[model samples]
Target chain A: MSNLEQIAKLSGFSKATVSRVLNQSRHVSQPTRDKILAIMEELDYVPNGNAISLSKGQTMQIGMVTEGINEVMLPFLNSFVETASQYGYQTIIYTSSGDPKKELQAFEDMRRKRVDALVISTCVNDLALLGSYCKYGPIVSWQRMENPQIASVAMNQYDGYTLGLEHVISRGRTRIANAYGRPSSINTLGRIEAYEDAARRHGLAELPQWSRTGIHSIRQGEELVREMLAVEDPLQRPDAVLCSNDLVAAGIVSEARRRRLRVPEDLAVVGFDNTELAHTLGITSIYNPIADQAKNAFHLLLAKLGGACEPQQKLQYCLVQRATT
Target chain B: MSNLEQIAKLSGFSKATVSRVLNQSRHVSQPTRDKILAIMEELDYVPNGNAISLSKGQTMQIGMVTEGINEVMLPFLNSFVETASQYGYQTIIYTSSGDPKKELQAFEDMRRKRVDALVISTCVNDLALLGSYCKYGPIVSWQRMENPQIASVAMNQYDGYTLGLEHVISRGRTRIANAYGRPSSINTLGRIEAYEDAARRHGLAELPQWSRTGIHSIRQGEELVREMLAVEDPLQRPDAVLCSNDLVAAGIVSEARRRRLRVPEDLAVVGFDNTELAHTLGITSIYNPIADQAKNAFHLLLAKLGGACEPQQKLQYCLVQRATT
Candidate 1:
């Protein structure tokens, strides 16, 4: 007889009772459970994978963790949701609020929900903890991290910035301005690095007064420009600006108009994300293939969950020049 | 003894095998399965709800269906995701490209995946079809429909336009233009009705040239204006514009600058959705309290799924005037 049958007989109970106990059923009395568990332990009984899967069937779910879906995330999210469903998997969303404790809690909740995998975006902190979650299941991110277990689909944001910088510099924009979301974030740091590299290469001086950080919204983007305009020194001001997002770029453009600063002639500008606002306003901006990124991320998670691991995916990006440059 | 016990004894099999057969296990022989099923039918054995929930335990997953997320849905989506998670439920996103067959297919798929509930946004054509899906589980929408089975949290989008109309009219503007996503959509119709009402009350002429349909984007907003500008009759052109969305409003502002039209002086403009772009561009717009709408929709779904049905919620709106008006 098999170990299960032996345990059933030894415990003076049916196989159903032993099975229920293994599945962690509360109906089984403490004495009966203890007796059956001891017998199973003595026999070195291990529950089969089929039994576990039968109890916890395919949820066909992929959980998404993000730092609360913001403007740049919205379009990407729409594409991700559509693309993920197309892949025969349902997509679940969890907002982590970028808090370490809250992020870990969200991860734990996703695990308990038996999500097939997780796709995270812009993890400002708690990356190590997030990386540790890969052992539990497939984990993919928007960052191109070095870890092999955790896969990612990332845009060439840094290189895209360089292209933008070169375009603006070529336009004779010597005093360049820029903005950042979280100055400390790896994404922001990398972008800042590329800007510095491009500036040094082009022999353009980096003015501290021109760059701003901690800008979170379009209003702030306008305020950032207003602050730039407030400075008394004519030579200290930026001849052109590059924004972290299109919303901010739109804000800067609006504010520039309010001050009667002619675009391109008075001050050239560029925006990132290539959102609808960019196309509408005719602003030069970086176009990250958001839909492609979503598709790649979904496929990456699908591959990892299917037990075929792939390396980190780096998606392409470009500067879409309109009238702003 | 219970029917299950009687069926097991009559089949001359252990309860485990009988239970497995009922749960659709392939381990049992055909003869055994037929015999056991026959016994079960004869005994009228009914499986309890706990058994089903155990098999498809609270995936805690709520599938969301939308007619493809767009610019207007972004703020609502962000809040919906955050609010749903706050109420101890995870959110799943499914984008139906507004295709009737595709939407129904998505619904059936979500049902197969055993999502606890579904929340839909802007069902333009497939509403009745979507309404029929309430029988499977709880269905909530971003519309306050007459169907009770499909609970909703809707915005007063009609009143929002009226408010916009009144604000601009109060500011001594008579020739007003408006645009929409799908001109025939219920949302657009309601807004149009309010616009008509407000126009009559204000004794303003309804120039057919001023009200354009099928304005899908900001570029379209500008195109609408350019089309207005093309009209040889100066009397037919609008003195102010009321846009379907803030992106469109921003576009009008951009286009106005291109034509050297001073806003609120030459052509005042108002927008809906009150997005960051609206505030950035200093456009007068309608604020729909999207976060509140999202929270109410989530709670309504929560109540219905938790076995207590709640009435549909109608969220209010307001006109926020800025430099543009």
Candidate 2:
């Protein structure tokens, strides 16, 4: 006889009664169920419950590994959580601030905790570590990685920047510069590539001094613009500036205004994200469809975990024209 | 004989090996473990493993129920998750958009899943429903509630607004108006009370047209400011506009600037949140101590869960004066 049968007989209960208690059914009397649970607890009979549950399939749990703090983090997480809830799945969130060591630990913990899948939202340079974690479960990345094993939802940041730059160039401005966070980040690198392409296409000379990188805050934007404006050379001045975000663009606008330069007419500016601030300030911006990206990422992960291997997705972005451009 | 004896005897091995396999111990050989697991699976012996595990204690899981989308959600979640991780706990998030039924479901789900604790970040008017869930686990709220049973990390929004409004009044601006989110929300109500107190104390006649309600976006700010400026009565015109957030202030600033009105000189504007945009645009605003609130909320919840009773906490906010005011 099996261990379950032994427990049933020892408890003086039928196998169905024991099973009902195990399943946490409400039909069983409280005292009888409590006595059975006490006996089972004493025996230490269910130590491998999590593993057994995983083998039985469908924990209804999705793991999300994110950097946890970003402009996109809350919106993406909101969309993902709502969408996951619609599919009767609960989401477990882990944030490591892009730390690979912590990310590995998160993967290990998620595996031990028996999550069905993982969505990696943070920008990670380490591909091997991410690939190794695939052994634990289905892994989906927010960025488009060309890897066949890992699925991705790619953001069309390159084309978006290209379009923004083209808009600036078409408006008869030749001297252009870009400032953004972390030149090493993949998105920034893509933007840089697009910036170079636009400069080359428009026959605008790329000023080494004009290309400002490692700019993260509005204060940085003010400092950078002031530094550029302090340039004594007239020919070296950028006629137009493309900022990493609305805040940076706002800083540039304020500083330029302080110098009595009219926006668009004197120093044209374009910002990214098309945030509420961008719209309010009438800033030309690139709109990354955060909600769409979130939905697609969740669906792709869900489909993969549900036995259908969905292809990697690439979402589109739009350039919104406003007063600044 | 018990099921343990039956399984051990049936496998021609000792109960210790059987127990090791059930515990997922690496000490047992792969083949032995696999054979024992197969037999257990066939017999449906591990069905009550989850219940047994719960009784054994410490699932290391904490459930967070939020409204999912808010300016504060991402930043708050970042702090909560990091703090939870420090305590060796994993967070499962549920967002119901303030739906009480779904929140009730979340509580039930958390209880059924055997989560050790719960954190409620969503705003709910009903205290009775929340009180009912206290039996499931230790519960902590993110808002200031009068319930002695529920510990909260309260935000001093009332005093924060009073301080902001008083600053505007001190700057010799008589025609003061307020703009904010849903009037029904507790935060906005507090702000309204402060607005009234400021207007009454300063002996400024309340202009019906000056008070704008249900303003949520930058566009709304622009529209409302435009509407205010269009008012024919000179006595009703607001000289200063206090916005719900930096985004709104940006909108008011942009609209005012569009009509050649100099900020602070002609029209004073103050925004709340002191977000990056506010700094970039040089808007005077109130800074909500997000990180401090997050830390305190986590510590409050942690203390309650750790069997140490912590009193309800109220974090302070400060007004940051910049160029716009």
Candidate 3:
């Protein structure tokens, strides 16, 4: 039998009166409500959350979609989950595994589930398609989209790249080489644009051979040093290298030490994303405030839910100087 | 007006007929059903998922609770989510942040939400309380609990410790020290029992000063070497150290190299959790198959949902030897 029916049979009360108590309707007498609640506790009964949410016209749940997670996104996800939980919202996570079709399916699932809001950590679909999803609920993207209708909270990637480049240049190191991730990624494209702009402003010729893509790991950093730095003539090699992240910079440092090359004297290295690995290795890096961005993203979605149209927000990054430079 | 009301009005069908069509009742004529469905498509009507689920007697959702994530739990969570998603189950996450009260509250939330199953990554609550929750849904714990009523999937810590110790013994190291995480933790307690038993069997003296607790990070490994290994009498110190994890092992190796001490010949280091950091730093570690454990946990929960009483599963660890040993 259903829980309400059992309660009604035991309390000698009608099902409608029992439901009135469950819904906290003032029409029910105080004694009747107390008796129904006591019987509920005795039976260890839990009311249907779905029914309650349906009556309230809100689910009090958020749907979060990501292409996939990496070291950079891990803490952000954890922080976002914690913050949302504190506000009484449960986060349903859907990892698309870098598939655009899967991301679209996740949205469809959310729409059918009727979540209160949507948070897109990664999206590869067209902006117009994403904007159309706004009808289902308020949508927020972690990456900046050109569509004004979608709320976005993202870090300024161009400024981060410029920070790393300027720090190396400040140390009087010209002829700088660059190591980056996938060329097609939005972040990498922004960095490439900033690198070229900085090189032109500094009157430094951009050498195609000096720039390497798909450098994400420490081993990749070491490989970059081997392929570009170990030249017959020392002056032919770049004096400084700008890495995609701390792992790549760590690789460069380890490789340089193995070859008995002095850092800053023989080669200056700058890394991005000041992770603990960067701090431990003392590599100069650009600090990306991922935790802060995650917290703000939750708040931005909350604003959208509150019927406020928030403008796109761009957070900043700063350079943390350390032993490498 | 509600989407259902609009669809009924547009199709010129009675509300009862519209709901019957929505529920796929054969009593509704084919032409009437088609007309209703067409109007639904034009109105972009998404049926109330909660109401549909209420009638089906299942949520098609799972609830996962964790006591805050760490490097070890991150991949495990991702793998579990991906596996669950592939099976058409949406995962709702709640992070308790190591608070027992919060864990209890999360259980209450899951019970109200009526998730099909519950996955507990970490819990410090009483087992009897968790056992009582079985009425709400099946519960699967990542950590091993003494309660036979709750399903669990955990790595064999004692065997893992023995594997690391035996490997070091084979390398001709007699006096070995140990670095561990919180002494009160179940994993550490198991390791302590294994270490004493192995020492007694091998006729090696168990020195109190050789054991260090709360050693988790790379910096702690460096500090351990500085405190114990910098002794003037080389014979008085341990020839090798067993680390709590790869981060500690990496620290030991880095500090030893900085102090001009050769690894293995001077201080052999064995680590746990065979992470990529261990591979990059070349530390011999006991490989804990977290991804496999996560996948198995989901399958075990599925078995529970199928009414199968599964026994507790203890996964094994293997030693991966590298340059550090």
Top model number, TM-score:
3
lDDT of 3 by residue, B84-105 (tens): 8777777888788777887786
Q: Who wins the DockQ comparison?
A: 3
User: Candidate 3: which stretches are off by over 4 Å?
Assistant: A12-17, A25-32, A182-186, A217-223, A229-234, A254-265, A307-316, B12-17, B24-33, B182-185, B218-223, B229-234, B255-262, B307-316
What is candidate 2's lDDT per residue for A1-325, written digit by digit as tens?
A: 8657877988999989988887788999999998889888777565233434544655677888876655535567778888788887778888776676766666775455457788877745477667776766788877656567777776757888898899989999898888866666667888889988887877888877788787755677677678767888855778888888776887787787777667888678998878666776788988877766777888887777764545545567789999987
Answer with 2 or 3, whichever has the higher lDDT. 3
DockQ of each candidate relative to the true complex: 0.22, 0.33, 0.57
Total clashing pairs for each candidate: 0, 1, 0
Q: After superposition, how far is residue B129 of candidate 2 from its true place, in Å?
A: 1.6
- Superposed on the true chain A, the predicted chain A of model 1 yields a TM-score of 0.78
- Which candidate model has the greater TM-score, 1 or 3? 3
For model 2, the stretches where C-alpha displacement exceeds 4 angstroms are A1-56, A259-261, A307-314, B1-56, B259-262, B307-314
DockQ of candidate 3, scored on C-alphas against the true complex (2 decimals): 0.57
User: What does candidate 2's lDDT look like per residue over B1-325, in tens digits?
Assistant: 8667778877878899998887777899988888887777665464332334444555566888776555535556778888778777778898887777776756776556446678777655477767776766777776666567766676757888888889989999998888966666667878888888888888988866667778866688788767876878745678888888776887888888887767888778988877776776788998887666766777776776674445545567789999888
Q: What's the lDDT of the predicted structure labeled candidate 3? A: 0.81
lDDT of model 3 at position B270: 94
TM-score ranking of the models = 3, 2, 1
Q: After TM-score superposition, what is the CA distance of residue B176 in candidate 2 from its true location, in Å?
A: 2.5
